[model samples]
Target: MDEDSIDHNKSVIIDIPTDLESNQWSKCWIHRIPRKLRKVKESAYTPQLISIGPFHHGREELKAMEVLKEKYHQKLLQRLPKDGSVSNQMEEFIRDSYKEIHGRYAGLSNNGFDDEDQAFEKIIMRDACFIVELFQRNDSKKESDDDYILSTPWLKKAIKLDLIMLENQIPFFVLRQLYTITAPHLPSVNVPITQASNHMNPFLKLTCSFFKDHIVKESDWEKFAEIKEIKHFTNLLREFWLPREFIKRRNPQQKDIADRKYLYSATKLDKAGVTFKRASKGTSLADVKISKKPVLKFIPASKGMKLKLPELKLENDTECLLRNVMALEQCLYPKEDYICGYVALMDQLINTSEDVDFLVERKIITNMLGSNKEAARLFNGLCNQIPREKTFYARFYNDLNKFYENRWNVTRSTLKKVYFKDLWTGSSTVVGLFVLVFTVTATIRNVYLRHL
Candidate 1:
């Protein structure tokens, strides 16, 4: 063969590496819902009104929001000093931080763009500015009927839900960086950073305000203030709801329990002499505990013993919110699946409409869906995309099962429910027993008299 042919053949054969470091394969936390999971409920995973991040950036349906993003960007520029021409400086900052911002997203390099660096910088600047402005608007005290998003209740609600989706997120660091530069320029009334440290770190207060309703207590926000690194809004939200003790106790390498058996439903537990009461409003949902002793003991004790459960407010948007959070946990923190564990526990407690009704009556659950069946379906559907695991409530489950299996407790509960349900029924039973005893005595006396 000629030299050219030989060289071509040699070039075609190349050696490939067989191994790589785990870090090389690592992916970012922001991710699309796996197709297998998304198929169960596509709408729950989708953004309806707006898209915040690259996952759904250029979809035709979401294009309208781009105009709004540009409008917000213009407003952000207006905040800067007119003589300084700070827009150029801001653009330069984005351009310089291009690689760092791009690295925050997984598989972004694979997506073909006309000019990747310019496109990325533009996206990051526009999105971060839009978010900073939107949060400020939400946190503002004064009412403005002229504002479109806040004035329309449904619009505000939709935007809030969209902002927390797993795929629809920008890195929290990026948003914080943009806010640091833009905050000083905003109107004095708009920026509420009175303290120096707070001025340096303003996003925390803005985020807390945006999620005020979910916060169980005022102190919860203070707890969040101590954390230095937050991945994104959804992750922050998950952390916010977690008990402080649980957060401290979490060990990523700890062994996960392999038990996957189903626990008894609320109604079944009730029938087995386990009563339910609402837990304190400030308690974390994951901190469900069963009391070993009865809450109350009268001279004549009640039939069933009670368990204190945390109150859960169910609304129309609850399912959507929970499903997205669960998806994020499943994808990002499978080992520390706090949200998943809580949902699994709820699933065990609520199997049917009757279980929901029992919880609603006990105030353990507030149903705003207008029907118990709807609430049941919402809970039952939440676990469809995620696999069941040994939940944090495993101890409660074991204790409840042991309590239910005791024959004496079961018998006592059944008797109390059947024979002495109310005061009138107990009075009738007592009267009947007295009359029977007297009749028997008179019969015996007559027999004795006859013998005499």
Candidate 2:
């Protein structure tokens, strides 16, 4: 810690132990986004996404989610905030959150959604704090009651009026997040049936298309084009225009469809999944009545999946926004939980804080700007006058300048400042940076001279 090496970090390091067992399963440190959920929106877009009415969002009925997902893959042609925060800040959050959940539950697989009954039952039951507690202590209905937990008065208030299903004890919060569509029908089909769909059923296709066409109908294509800088029908082109190639891929009774969905959803769920069924569902102490023949074999309908946004599942623009919000509210946890959260924050505050290269670049500029005061002093002078709002990139430029000038002696700090600096960027000090590199020949020369 040289006097020349001004402490770049304004705050002191809180050296928490990292001796926890290796979390090979966590991806907080890695560069991967989960597989996208391919949901279709029902009907038109509402500024406030009131389902407006009961509508289906089956993936086959709508490739909109898949379409929106593809757009996420495309460079965000435009965004409101434009700082990369609004669009992707949560993605990294999810990756790390998934990692923490996975590590916390050792030996669990990533695609744990498919076996939601057996696997995630404990997790959801334990984690569903408010609702689970209500069921445990308050619900007066016995397990033998006709409606069971549905008989609880708290449930009626907790669930949205839009939701008609009361039999299955799916968490109301979970149902809301899934964008479940419900009518006053006999069998309430709480969609998100399985993490991903088993079949792109034709009726499913009709349902999805109904929503798709309706959304597109109301879309102001001209206005969207204006924002996105496209020539015409950009909404339709980007949102609905099919990949002429999709027709080739379509086939009924393809054995692979079910397998692909199974494998893909399972793999995605394995990363991070929770069960719809609560732990208290089974209280029967009597000897099990194992039926040799099953009753038309039932698979869990409300299986959970990682909340991949509209981009991967590519829905209409509005739908994408809604789902993205849903994911953040549901899946993401506090940033401090993941290694990336710590590192990302460190990068911001330390390496690329307000005065991004304040310590290193100033030192380099002071040194490499040839002890010259012009660039270095001018930089410091500007920094002192940095408008609070402009300090972010201004400090970046200051360090970047030093990096180029004293490049030969440039430290890792310079590289980070010039290249990435996306971290904190909320810096203040325009300090100094100095990295000393010793060549073998130089070392030998010094040694020989000392001996002589």
lDDT of each: 0.74, 0.25
Q: Please, what are the lDDT tens digits per residue for candidate 2 over residues 1-452?
A: 76444543321221111334664534221111111221122221211211111121122433333343233223221322456553343333333344343343223333525454333432332222222222222222342144322454443322322121111122222212112211111122322332212343312322222233323222322212222121111112232322222222323111111111111121111122211111121111110111112212473432221111111111223223332222221122222111112112112223212222332332211123333223233222211211122111233223323323443323433444554456434231121221123456678889999999
lDDT per residue (tens digit) for residues 1-452 in model 1: 99999976654432111233545224466766766678799998899879886778788899998898888778777778887656777777788877666666655553755576677677778888888877777666553255577778888778878888888898888788777777777644343443422633677777776666753244456556556578988888777666556666554434345343577899888777787888786676666666755424663443345688778889877887788878887777777777787888888889999999999999989999999999998888788858765556666667777778777777877766776779998888789889999999999999999999
The superposed Cα distance between candidate 1 and the true structure at residue 400, in angstroms, equals 1.9
- Return the number of clashes found in candidate 2: 34
Q: What's model 2's lDDT at 342?
A: 15
TM-score: which candidate is best? 1
